[model samples]
Every structure is written in structure tokens, then in C-alpha cells.
Target chain A: MTALPMEAEILTRREESPGLFTLHLRLTDSAAQQAYRFRPGQFNMLYLYGVGEVPISIVSDPREARHIGHTIRAVGRVTRGLERLRPGDRLGLRGPFGNGWPLGDCEQRDVIVVTGGLGCAPVTGAVQYLMRRRERFGHVNIVQGVKHADDLLWREQYECWDRMPDTTVLIAADEAGPLWPWHVGRVTDLFDRLRFDPAQAIVLCCGPEGMMLAVAEQLQERGIAAERIWLSLERNMQCGIGLCGHCQLGPKFVCRDGPVFSWREIAPLLRVRGR
Target chain B: MATDCTLVAELRFLAAADRQRLIEALREAGYAVHGPRVQEGVIRYAPVERIEDLPRGWRDIQEPGRYRLRQTDENRLFAWAAPAASLKPLVFPPREILFHARRDADGRLRFEAADGAAPKLAVLGVRACDLAGLYLQDRHFLQGAHPDEAYRRRRRKLFLVAVHCAHPADTCFCAATGDGPVARYGFDLAISELEEGWLLEARSHAGQEILDALPTRAAGETQRKAAEAAFRQAAAAQRRRLPGGDLPARLGGRLDAELWQAVGRRCLACGNCTAVCPSCFCHAHVEETPLTGARTTRLRQWDSCFTAGHSLLHGRPVREDTASRYRQWLTHKLSGWHEQYGRSGCSGCGRCITWCPEGIDITAEAAAIAGEEA
Candidate 1:
């Protein structure tokens, strides 16, 4: 809640892809770290000391309260600077902000996580949450799509999830290579093989708006109620809190009201261009 | 001490010359008094010591994209509709350092929260519209579950002196917004400026103390009537009005009106309207580091929706064109604000109309979007 950033040391770092990486951070103030709690879909305003901050989803499990993980794509000014950081390098962090995915509503119901491109990071935490409490849910299905086959980052992690009982991991590439083993075409193409009872399913989605819209349409046509489908939207989230006005969409502050919202609550707004 | 019963509705009269004494009393109480003064041909809030510091014997002639101050034979303070900006900067500063991060030789990064302790400030001659704007801003920064500490620290020390408008600008529509002409709330002392002296009413306990300390007499029936008549005339004189009631709903449905495109063609996307808007709270966090890179200062500077960077996400601007930007600002101010703050964001002070280089009249634009003539 404090606007001031707290110092968090980079405990570990991993290069997920050429322009994508993950940084495991631990708050220097152990007491503050212990006090910090975040939901699966929520994000943190990660600051690169001398550079500005960027809103990145927390990829670590909420159960691991002290250790926080953020997978970042070096696509902007702040993220490009963060790419140079290594273990033991310290940065500023302020967060555990925005409404996360609706895991509580997923109890005893199928949890379908849909993502596109680098959008898998936000949902990865939720998928991990479901994996830890595997017995409580009906089924787990993760469907991800990328522009190119080589753009996929977490192949091993998806393979690990595919081995879990009552869980399905399907990945697709728009431009498939000769050696690509997954399905070809958009994430919508993988829907035919996805296993879930649409009537009793909760779809958590994050990605490009076009992809999400297509996914929502596909799910609705397949009999999933609009209210059961949730989406995490991204905007210019400068302040983790709602005070900064950049992230507003219609009446909602994407950073506060949601990074995740029910399709029924946000569907009408998605139709408007340049909102 | 007088009984508490009469404090709520009591009115006192201060002689024209005694205004300086009131400023002195506030200064003695450790408040830095700021009032409207002409600076660089525009009236803005600045430090004031004597009555002469106020923009006396001056009235602003305001129209769409135009503002000019003309000297008047009669001497009166606060005859203008509004200053170039409201009291927003006094509480939420245009630029503020949130915190500082320093790097040590051993690669240890230490962050220190900026000391946000603010000076006790007393703003004089505030208008009803400005007060309404401040009230909405208070909801934005303080009423939330996680109140902004810096804004709270500054807001807690403010001593507001409200002034009922006796002359409204042609561009003003506070009357339509239901926030102006008469000072109703959010002030320690509400003043009704008259020709001979000033009629003051205490709305808060602090206001009563200042009223008691001043060389004031109980206002006669004639003075009270004059005060009411002045405020009434001000309201009736307004040539502009922003239609209320279901405006938020009405405007929400008109987001795609081609009028926005037309307005966009003329709109410069300069953000002058937001800069002068009393309730605009958008800011950008900027990091400043020296060439040596030993320390970094993170500061939040006032930002506008018109800027392409305001809606930038992954290098893509959500509102890529001026029309969309204008739509975002107008829709948010009229409709989106109601959903967020439970009311409209505009105070209808008309600074946006007067100060915009393109002279874009929000009232006219809103009317056009609603399929009405300006």
C-alpha cells in the first residue's frame, strides 16, 4: 500500500528466451517480505534502481511468500535495463497489486487457463496454484499459442504439467516449423482437443485483446457461460494503485479493479476501439 | 465564548481595510497564506502578505481560448471567475519526489522514502467549484483504503477560506455542475465579498476562532441580503451550463460520435485543458539519475491523457490518435469519473475553456456529443 519502493535483492535470474527472462527476488527487509502476499494473477511494480518501474505479473506461488518471481520481456525502456541485472543485484519493488485470477471460484470446477505469446507468465502462477492443490479442482487445462514455434518459452514446464493426472497442456504455433510437435494455428485451433466440462469450467485468460476476444467467442460457442470466463487485461500501469490514471479502461482502473475481470463485466468494453 | 448553537449560521462583517489583519492573524498562527495574484499577465495562487497582494481592481474577461484582465474603477478582491489553476498543486504538487534509491560501492541498494512533511498552508479566496474539485480529489487520494501518504500529509495541514462568486465568466458552468456561485462546504471560512466590506460565515471550528479574533461585528439584515443577492446574480449571469442528470450515462453511449473526430482535427493534443483542470490527478513516475549513477530519485510529474506515452503498453499506445485521446479525457471526466468517484470529475471552473490554446470548449463539445447545439 505504501507508494515508496522497498529494496529487494535479486536471489536468482534465468534467461527464458532471447528477449525474455525471469528474476527471483527477495525483499532485503525480511519482515516486509513475510508480510507481502499476492494472488496468482496480480502484478508487482518492479523498479530497476536507476531506471523507472514496469508492472510485471508475479510468476511465483503465493505459498512461497518470501520468494517472489517475475518473468519479464525486455520490450521497453525499463525492461531493457532490467535485462542486465544479475543475482545479488538489488532493485526496488512495490506491489502485490490488482485483482488476481478467481481461484476461489475454481473449487470443484474445471480450471482452463488460456494465454498467448509472452502472456503465459501471469497465468503460470495460477496453474502452479492448481498443481499444488490438484485434488480440489475438477481438471486443469493450459492452452497457449505463440506467433512462431521458437517463441514458446516454457516448454519443459508445460511438459511437466502434461504428465500430471487430470491435467492437459496444449500449445500451438501460428507459424509452425517442420520439427514442431504441437498443433498448428491459433490457440482457438487447440480447443477441439481441450478437455473440460464447459458448463462447470472457469476460464482464466491473458494475452492480446484480439486473441482473448477470439478465445472468449470460442468458449461461449462451446457452452461456457460468460461469467465463468475471466481475463487479465494489461495497460499503462504506472502506479500499482489506482491513483495513477493511465491504466483506466471505461470506469475500471486495470491496475486496481483488475488485471483479471469476468468476461460478463468487461465484454461490452472490449468492442470499443482506442479506449 | 458564544454558545455553539449560533456558530453554524452566524455571519460577521469585516471592514474592507481589516482584511490585512486577517492575513496577519493566519500568519501568526504559523500558516503560510497564499492568495490569487497577477503573475505574467495571468492570475495564479502565490504568497501574499498584504491586501494589495491580491488581484484587486481587476477582473478577467474570459471566453473560449481567451483570457484578458481589464482594470476596473471599483475596488474589489476576487472578482475573477477562477485562477489559471485551482488549489490542486497546493496539495498534490505538480512534481514530487516519492523516494530515493542509493547504491553503495558493495552493490547494496538502499531506498529511503521521501520526507513528505508539508508546510501548514492557508489558501484564501477559494471558489466553490475549486472546493468541489478538492472534495473529489480527496476521495481519490485519501478516501481510498490505501490513502496516498504524501497527499494526506499535505491535505491535513490545509486551511481553506472559501469565497462565493459574485461574477462568473462567460465560459463558467459551475452553476450547471451544481457546485458554485454559493459556497456550501469544504471551507473553514466562507466569505461573501460586498462593496463596503466582507460578509463571513464560519463553517468549521477553526473558522470560528478566526472570526472571533478578527475585529468583526454581527452582520445586519441588509448586508446578509446583499451577500445573497450578489451570489444569486453571479449564478444568473452565467452564459454556460453543463447539463447534469444522466450525463454520464448519456455520454457513455456517445463515445463513437463522429463529432470527436471533427474535434480531434482542431485539437492540438497539447493537454492545456488537463493542466488547468482542478481535479485531474494523472501523473507519471520519472527516475532521475546523475551521470555517475550513484543515486536515483523517483519523482511523479503531472501527466496528461493527450500524451501518447500516457497509454503506452509494450510500446503500443492504446489511444493512438488525438480523437481517441480527446474521447478518453472527455468520457473519463464526464462518465468514467462517476463510476470511480460516484460523481462527475469536472468542477466547471472553465479554466480549461479559457486556457486551451485551441480554445476547445468542453461544454460545447459535450453538448455536440449529446446531439445538442452549443
Candidate 2:
């Protein structure tokens, strides 16, 4: 059946940072809720009634079936409109679309999560999933980079995950203030402080294209095979089912073929400008 | 081989007057027949009740950025190739309401999916290239895991009557794409317009049934031979050809080529080429709110890669410049589409060429890239 936006009521709203917030929605339709199972990196098309729809990554753990969570930054008209949403407010949702992060592909391999700025939203669910089932993976590492210390969205969540056994969290802010207690540099700069078996590690990266490219290159230099490195890419995605054709990058429809792809598959196309 | 022989043996011929009988037969069989008719100065696909609705003796002359209909002495119905409009709009409409949402008096919001019950349609006079384009569209909308219910519903009982191109247009290069001049398959019935009468070949059981009921006679060997010869002539008349051998790789490797910059300079970013393209399927969603603002209907409208909004990411357009947008369009059609859809996107109908106001010939641009080594 063709995807249609089902009515969902905002159960809770949280302001993560300046102009960045997360909305927890409970599907008003019981049938829609039962059918709306999603993987870690899959996204939902949130339709703001009378405004428009925007593709937002599902930021909550996939295990939580009752309520779905979406972290959004007010970057465009639709996102800014979403900022006005309050608890009990009604909106529309159509998704759990796009290929999610290949958690199964990690298996017993070491998992390295790398993100910059608000790019962490897509990978947060996967990180939480890994933390819940920590025994399934070898080592868990979350490496993040933001322009300023205040730009970090989920500081408390990072702190919570950092204290978990066998999990490593590394943060880097380019312009750190007195309140900042993490490493003060670019994300690539934090690679020198971390130690892991590159052969047994699978890297998951998400950020601006340039940042992801740099991170992938750094990971490749550390002897991680290109096939083991996965990156969540972003394009102008509409109709998250791949029909709209906006999120096309080379041969891949980011909505269908992937928002999550192995670095080896996208490496050649990444070199091309304006793809 | 046996089936092929039997299929050819079942070929029938219909005189020009009996064409009207065929339309009536289709109508009696519960099909709303649609064909090309000269509306204003251009030929557009519209509902047809009689043979007079077809653009008879009115052949179109099409070149890059040029389309003119002129009266020819030939009394044949399928005298010309495809008009500016192709078979796209029949399956994928320009604008379609996906669904409607409304808030009730009790403050409960209700949603209704768009009704997908479409009228039984028989699209007549579809050219070989247009037929190929329709097949590609089917692959996208119906063959996928999540088939488009609306398109699938509309296409469920649809009938295709493919007309072989007897006269190739200047902009047309379907011969090069191996999709036109003659349609090998993917049509219910394939008609070849010969000088004497129409040589109709049934490609499917439904077509065979239709042929059995229509006013028709066995096609003579001479008529069949003449039809083949006409198709050959049409193919031989094509002046443009896409580069052979791994076209996807050839075009994909030239993303940074300077040829795109040259073509982009002339592009107005008006999206005319995409609008007229038989295979381009990009679309935008529009939310229609009434004056009361209590109800909203979401509509999907045809969109183009040329628009800045099409590639917008966080208030920034990915392909901001015309050069990049043009490159994305051509490369996706010729190169990336092969990997994405397991086939080339362009059916070589050349509607994009004739309809483009800037006359940006895709074939010319592709050839330039193919000619370059790097």
C-alpha cells in the first residue's frame, strides 16, 4: 500500500539546544502504531497540518513501540513550523522509511559511532540500541564534534552512555568555553587518543558531507576496510519512499537504496561535486 | 519460436474506415479510449469518440526548440511520431490528490486515503518510444516492493495500442535507444500504418480477443513486408545516436567535464525539458488548505531537477547552479539510472529536446562528453 501520513499526537516535547528540540509522538491510530515498526537509522516524514512535511530521523530506541521520538533542528520553514508543536498537538507521520543502519552487519565487530553537529540525531537510536545489547558487539565508541561546546544537543545522554561499562565516548568542540570539559579540537583530531583493532571495527559516521568524508578518510588511514565503514548521508529527501527523486546521489536514492550506505559503495560518487 | 510464428500468423489488417469500428469495439468492451487530437496549434492526448479525433494527415515537424503541425497529403492516422505530450500523463498525472485530512467537531483529526478506482482506459496511438517509457514507469511504480497504489489502480485495466513510427521526427532518436521505430513488445496490440491499411499484430491474449472482434482480415505477406520496410526506413532516418558501449560508465566518469558548463550557460532553469520528458518522474507535494483552514488536501505535482527547491537541504540547495542541475539531470538519465533502475532512464522520445526553449539537446551534450577522454 502507498504510504499515508497517520495522525499522531505529540506526547512530550524537549528543547535540546537553541532552535533544536525533540518531539515524542504517540500514534492516535492503534493500527498505525502496530504497523509502524522502525529500525535505528530509519526516518519518518512528519507532516505539520496546514504547513508541510519534513523528513526527520527517528531518534528514539527501536524497542519503544508505543511512542516514537524525533529530534529536529529548526533549519527550514517546515522545521521552524514544527518548533511551535506542543504536547497534545496533532501532526501527521508517514514512515519508518529508508534503509537503516546495518546493526546486524556489525555482529561481533567493534562499533565506532562518529558524528558532527546535529548529524548525531540519526545515529543516536543506534547508539542507544547498542548500549542496551552491549554484549552483542566487541567495543562501542561514540566520537562527536561540534563547532562550539553549546552546540552539542544531547550532552546528558552522552554523559550517561559514557559511564556504561565497555563503552567509550569522545567529544570535540572547536571553540570550547570554560564550561567545556572534553577535548577541544576537530573530530579527526580525537582519533589519536582512541585505540581499537581496526580489522575488527565497523565505523558508523554521520555529519555534513565534508566532515563525513574527512572522518571516513581518517578511519581508512587507521586500517579499517572501506566496506566496514558505514555513513548516513543526507540529501533533499521528500516522499521518503524514493518516489519524489529529490534525494538521488549518483545511482542511489538516499530514501530507498540508502540513507545508510557502506563507505566503499559511495566513495566514488562522493568525489563528484553537486551530486 | 512456435508462439512467435503463430503470433505473426494471427496478424490482421484494418481499413481506414474500420478504424472507427475498432474504437467502437473498445468502447463497447468498457474502455474510455484516448488518442491525440489537434488542440489549438498543438496535438494533445484527449478523449476520442470517433476516428476524426485523431490527428489525421496532420504530421508534426519537430526539431530542437521547434514543433509545428502541417497538413500532409498522406491520409494515414499514424503519420507522425509522438506529439509534445506522451503517455506519461495517462498513468502519472501532473497533479493528483494523495489524501485529505480534516479535524472533526470533537477535535479528533481524521485522514482518508485517496480513492484509487480509475476508469478503464484504452490509450490509442502510443508510439514505440512512449510505450517503452510507459514500461519504465511501470518498473518504477508497479514492479517495486511498495507499488504506488494510485498508479497501480489506474493502470490495472489499462490497454495499450502502440503505433509504429512511420515518419521519424528531427528531435527523435528512439532508434539509437533501441526503443522505437518499431515496438517489439510491451503493448497489447502493435499497429504499423502502411500506405494501404493498418497492419495490426496481437501481442497478448487480450489484444488477440480485440482483433478477433474488430473488422479485420488476414494481413497479406506484402503488407507485412511493407510494414517492416517502413519501420526500417524510420530507423535509418534518425540523425542522432547515443554513444554505444557502457554509456552509464562513460557519462558517470565525466561529472567534472566542462561540457556541462557550456550547456548550463544557455539553460534558463525553467524545467521545460523535465516537464515534457516522457520518463522524468520527479514530483513535489503541495498541501491545499481551504479558507476555513479546518481541512487540508495533500497533492503531488510534477517537479523538475532544474528547480532550486528540488535539491534544497536545510535552506541550502545542493545543486545551486544551473550547470550542476543540468549535469545532475543528464547524468541521472544516462548514467546513474542504469545502476538505480537497472536500465537507462531516457527512452529517446526527444520531447525534452523539442519542448526546451533553450534548445539544450541532451544527445549533443552527451556526445560531447563521450567524445572527451576525461
Candidate 3:
């Protein structure tokens, strides 16, 4: 016979933004274990039978596990299958597979995080890592963008970030709103607002390919060699142990080598087409 | 010229009447016998009760996606290439167990092994190309780093009765892959059926043991000669021939070529090409939860590369376009697989072409590569 889902019930689910949601799964796996053991940016392949399985990045921290969480967007069959689920229901699971962000590497440099739209999921882990140990790093600046005010993933967090001392949050949207305050242009135009020493600060950028390309290019222009910039690559990753050969942008197995890479590491191998 | 192999055990031929006698001897020896019998216009393998169940004077012709049998005046056996269904499902069941589990009343969890004891299978009629396929799959699921233990258990316990091909079909590409038209390995007994009687040669002790128990006599040189002639005729009948020894290497180099897009335009990406093929062994897993809400993770199902989820991510599919997906499948088949597995994944079983809704021929694609070079 099958066992129960767990003792803890879901607190609530919040729509962070379009294609991104925060599901506060009740920590029924174990209560003593506050947070499930997960590294930053590691993904869970959520399974829903009658529909199938789809992988979503775990945006929560290992230190905080009141409920399991993910920023999921509806896309294909399985994700669409999941979007239809109401508050309380059984969810199947396969893994927290693949390598997450390097927790050990974040301590030394002042962090410059740039994210847009759904790309915020992976960055949230790094954000939680930094916020928990704010003094370990130097200054922290987060530059984020979306299509509109509604596209902003975490408005509360952004407001919280705007309040923090030594933290400069540059928020932008693609099109201007009559009441929209901070900025009213593509996030790429906000490059003038960023402080770049290149050596002192490590830049990590994630978002749509177009924005990633633009930010990465902007960083390269700032005397930050491609090696200094880390770009999260997207590929179709199934069976995160590198068994399924799904996401091969080239010879690299994105599931194994990275969903993250230094631009210099992949730049030569990456043959970008003319824009 | 060498007339026999070190593994070959010579045995006597049974007259037409002694067929039942030998069958009875085998039944007494505790074997579940299976052999070919004609039904519904084709030759099919069924559990035989007596020697009479064997298809006599039965011959088959295989075309793309179809198989048919015809009666001949001469009662020759081993007159077909191979069966429509592969031995792949027999060794590696369509769905089989990875692990079983129960969530205890205390809310604790326990896991159990699902696959039971392996049965001793007496496989009566696997062809040469099919054996090569088994050999190939053995490298994938059996001999690989992550060995499929359940498959290994079943394989080690089986009794193979290898039947040589006396007729090749249009889809047979065994000649190119060096796999065959006849049984090559793990066979207890190899039978090259002749018009007068079967040329019985035991390749292992189990086959000899079975022979010793049966009421049988020694086969003469004339009987063996007739069998060889028939075997040659089988090889001659094939219509498709995969060209060159460098296929594994050649196919590897062209993975990124735009030719894949060309092929994609025609492919439905249904994965039926791999499904019916004798050599393809990709699989998926599922866990069944009872009303009690405990889960049992089952490694019990077939999953094809054609599955969107197999290569999708972030609700964004990796092979978002059917064209790239097509490219990946063919590239893996012809080239990329050799990098990881040391051989092309194809077994020259033309079922992929025949069963294809588009009838996309790999031979034509291979020729296309060769043509571009010349």
C-alpha cells in the first residue's frame, strides 16, 4: 500500500510572477530536519501521474524548509498538468538531481546579480545564500527586469532589497507604465547604473537568452573578461545523472558540465548566430 | 577448409516419423518446448505439445511492416530470417521491476526487490542477426557499467536453440553489421535445417545432454552439405545491404550536418523506429501508489527518445523543434553512440524502415552520406 504524503499541510502558494510561482509545500518529509538537504539552484523533477514528470529548479534554501518550494512556470504537457492542480493534492517526486550553484565560491567577492523573469529561480538560491551571510561578501547589487510590473517575480523581496544598506537594487521593465517609477527601459539600458571593478565583483546573470547575451556582452565590455562572468545555460535535462543524452547544445552535457558556466569557458565552443 | 568448430557437437538425424519420439524424450527431460508453427498467414512461435506442432513445409517472406508464409512442396525448416517480434522483450520485459516499497503503518518506509527468480528459457528459434542484436544489447544493459541485474539473471539461465536463416528479407541489414543470417553465441544447440532432416550440432553441454536423452542417430556429410546450401540461399535472398566497415566512424562525424534537418522534415518523431526494432532498449520508470498512499518505484516500461519530456526542461523542451529531435535520434544511432558504447546502436533489422509510417530507410541515408563524399 502507498504511504501518506506527509503530516505537514501546505501553508499557501503565491504566484511570484508569470511562468514563476512559489509553492510552500508542507515539510512532511521530516519536521526535525527544518529544510530538506538541497544545494542552491539544484532542480527537482516533479512527477504527476496521468500526465508525467517535469524538472523545476528548487528556489528555496537548505536552511529554511518549513515547506518545500519551487518557482514553476507552465509550458508543456507535464508542467501544464501541474498548473491544473489545486491547493491540496499528492505530488510525485523523482529527485533533487544535477549540481546546484557553488556555495563555497560565493564568500570571497562582492556579488553582482542580474536576473530577468523566470531566470530568477536559480538566482533566489544565491540570494538566500548571500542574505543569510551578508557580511561574508562585499557590497551586493541586484539588477532585475521583466515585461511589466506584474512580471516582477518577488515584489516584497525587491522592496526588502531596496531597503537594505549597501544593497542597490535596479529594477526595470521593458515598456513604461504611467505610474511605474524606477526605470522604464530594457534592463540592458540600466548598464550605466552598475559599478564595475570586474576584479572586485563577480557577475552572475540568468534570464532569457536575449537578456543573458546582452548582459554578458555588457560585462565583457566592462573589462570583465568572459572568465569573470557566469551565465546559466538552459538545456533539456532528463535523468540528471547524465544518463539521458537530451540537452546537448554541443558536445557538452548540460546536466553534467553545467546549467551554469563562465562565458570564457563556453564562448569559444558556442557558435552564436548573427542577431 | 575447416569443416566444423571446436564448440560444435555432431549428432544424428531423426527420420520424419521419429520427430514425436524425440519431442517426447525432451518433454520427459523437463523442458518447456517452443517452436515455429504456421497460423494466420505467417510463421509464429508457439508452445509446442508434440513434434507435429513444428511448421513443416512452411516458409516466410518479410517485407516492410508485413510478414507472410507460403507452403512449399519440400518440408524444409529454418527457411525464414527471423520473427517479427524480437527476443528483446523476452530478456528485458517491456516493463520490469526496479524496486518495490511499502509505507508502514508507523509511517516508516520499506523497500523490496521486485523481479522474482529467473526462469530457464529454451528459446527455440533466434536468427543470426537477432543474436547479434542480443550481443549488442548485452553490451548496453548486461555488460555495461550500470548492469541491469534482472536481465543478466534471465540471460544466464536460458537455453538457446539457434536456427540459421535460409531466406533473407528485404529489411535485413545483418550482412553489413557482421551480425548475420544465423545464430552465433550463447546457443546450446544450433540447427541448420535441411530437406532430408535437421543438421543437429550441439554448441554446448546442455544441447549435448538433451541430444543424449533423445532417440536420435548420427548425421552424414550429405545432410550437412544440404544445410549449408540452404543457408547460402538465405543470405542471397536479402534485398538491403548496409555498405562499408567504417559506418560506425562515418556516421559519427556527420552528427551536426544539416542532413539531419532534411531527415527531420520527413520523420514524425513517433519513436516507432526504435520501438519495433530488435536492438533498441531505451526504457522509463514509474512508481505506483496504492490507496494507502505508499509508493513503489517501478523501472517497468518502455520510453522512447521521441518523448518530449525525455529531452525537455523548464517547461521548455530541449529539442523544441521536431527537426532537432530528429537530428539527435539519427546522430545517436549512426555516430554519437560509438563514442559512449563502442558500436552503432542499429542491428540491421529493417523493422525501423518497414514499420516507419514514412518508411524512412536507414540504408538510403547511409547511401546519402556515401554519395556526398564521392
C-alpha DockQ of every model: 0.78, 0.72, 0.14
Q: For model 2, how does the per-residue alpha-carbon lDDT over A133-223 read when each residue is reduced to its tens digit?
A: 8899887889999999889877888999989888889999999888889989899998876657898899999998999999998899999
Per-residue C-alpha lDDT of model 2 across residues B295-329, encoded as one tens digit per residue: 88989999999999999987889998999999999
Better of 1 and 2 by DockQ: 1
Candidate 2: lDDT of B246?
Answer: 89
Model 3 residue B101 lDDT? 55
Clashing pairs in 1: none
Judged by lDDT against the true structure, how good is candidate 1? 0.88
Model 1: residues with Cα > 4 Å off, grouped in runs: B1-9
TM-score per candidate, chains pooled: 0.97, 0.96, 0.72
Error of 2 at B201 (Å): 1.6
Local distance difference test scores for all models: 0.88, 0.86, 0.66
Could you arrange the candidates by lDDT from highest to lowest? 1, 2, 3
Q: For model 1, what TM-score is found for chain B?
A: 0.96
DockQ of 2: 0.72
Worst 10 residues of 3 chain A by lDDT: A1-10
